[model samples]
Target: MKKYKLILFSTLSLLITPVYANDNAEQLFNERCAACHSINDNSHITLRERLQEKAPTLYYAGNKFNRAWLQTWLAAPSKIRPGGYSFFNNVNVTDEGDVIDESKITTHIAVNSTLAALLTDYLMAQTPKSDLIALEKVTLGKINRSLGSKDFNKFKGCGSCHQDEEGYGGVSGPQLYESIQRLQPEFIASYTRNPEAWDPKTLMPNRHLNDNSIKKLLNYLNVISQ
Candidate 1:
């Protein structure tokens, strides 16, 4: 399977012309990603825009994603959101609550390693404007597994819907442990501050958490993921 994927990736490389080989990542982002993504902070986005959004904003993607994961994901697109950005759009009403219409779902646009690398670098630089999440202070608030586990499950009650371990926790939300590898510290910190600021329709609640609490949570996520 690995060999097959490699072959496919290599085949994809042949599609791009050498004329645009020296293409700027920022230019590539504007031309390729802008249609489906917002590269701005989106502080002024309206409720209608929120409901109509097709993909997540890239304004703070750098703060939210691991560089390695970004590179891999860009090169090989996969479905991260089981329910998708908007389940109502992609799902059909059946006897079941709602079943995703796999055929109507759009896949991510893939690029070769060169473009992916440059794009990843560009994407990583798109950090949030907020200076509230002080890296130095955040680093100091690191928590241990015992404390983190309790906070994750009991205090936050996050385990009610999110996967805790291999077979534990609820399946409604993404696995927090896996998220540790995929997300960046600053993004989590910013999102926790106000989930609606990024995505108005996001399921994540505005926990009204303080900077210190978020920093500790970030530390806990980092520790457990490692």
Candidate 2:
């Protein structure tokens, strides 16, 4: 009878452990991350609210980010967007062009390894767009680096906004050299295909890229990230 009781207790403990961890992670996220980032779905948020946001929404983090990268990034945060989350806030109108005031940008809050792991686990479970992510079918095809670079920089004009190499492109958009490491391939494809579908108030234009173009771009992103 004592043996059976112990077995039942062990089974219950195993089940309850995950719940407690989840609760703790949620509490930690609320305390440390909620001020800058949002875990709630903000698709219906007003344009003014979206423009005023301090950081990117994490409600679809599970669908968007690579788990390992997210974990590492949380522990040692870096600037993904050189111009800051709200680009308008960091840009200065100059005689040459609109220049990003790098001094105005702030780095993300870094957490210790334990806190990062807990936060990453919690954030990775918040996948509201699992269906959308599922719809994207990505195939890894080999693309020549030179041709890909030409297409990315000259033909497609992506270099005008995104950096395929560190400190080598415009600061208005998030750096793309580490995109494959940071973001899921499907999320990249989906966002590139239609930026407004993901963020209604996004500054990214709808280029209406075909599936072939997206695949080529994905291949290019993969090569550059590596």
Candidate 3:
């Protein structure tokens, strides 16, 4: 009778303990996705790095992707690329554009549906620690695309490696058409300031701009986001 009671208690502990102590979802995320996605800061490598392809960072996954959509995406990985998620601009890690290999991504372990649901629930709960401050109230008007092009090419030297319509840059960086929606300013600013903060293997060079240029570029990015 004591052995039967011990067995029952052990079974109950196995069932109930996981609910309290399990963090497998995060472990799974770190193991599978951390190679490509960043959560906190800029990477040490250039944006052209293979590990730095065009996938949106998980740092803002809580903000950008809706819960239901993320879950469905996990269950059945589909082609979300129109042209490609990551494109080469000019710093030149590869030819054309770099593509993030998301073809064999696993949203959940091959466990039962119940465990899959639990993983999804945990993943959706991860929100960025920083608040995203929208610049809509500050800009008050649209940024001129022509001026933006000029600034990107001539003033900031952004076009030296990144591609823009001005026909003056390299194809080493990712295209920046709708990047404002994809990247968080916090990560962008930090990377702009220091690429080593994120990944140690980045190839992008650090800029020597003063504070004013940084502010201008940041504001430019904010303006384009609109």
If scored against the real structure, what TM-score would every candidate get?
0.69, 0.86, 0.46
Best by TM-score: 2
| Displacement of the residue 216 alpha carbon in candidate 3, Å | 1.3
Query: Residue 40: error of model 2 in Å?
Result: 0.8
Q: Residue 209 deviation, candidate 3, in Å? A: 1.5
- Total backbone clashes of candidate 1, pairs 3 or more residues apart or in separate chains: 1
Error of 2 at 73 (Å): 0.6
Error of 1 at 221 (Å): 3.2
| Tens digit per residue, CA lDDT, model 2, 55-112 | 8999889999999999999999888987888888899878986688878888777887
TM-score rank order? 2, 1, 3
Better of 1 and 3 by lDDT: 1
Q: Best candidate per lDDT, number?
A: 2
- Write candidate 3's Cα lDDT for 1-226 as tens digits: 9999999999977754454226577765555456666555443446456454646556545544545655655665543322233433312344754433344332332344455465567755665433432311222234567776677778778766555532335544544444454454554555566654443555567776665566566666666656
How well is each residue in 58-137 modelled by candidate 1, as lDDT tens digits?
88777678899999989997766554666557667778445557776677789989888989888888766445344424
CA lDDT of every candidate? 0.72, 0.87, 0.53
Off by over 4 Å in 1: 1-18, 21-23, 91-104, 128-130, 140-155, 159-175, 196-203, 210-216, 223-226
- Candidate 3 lDDT score at position 84: 38
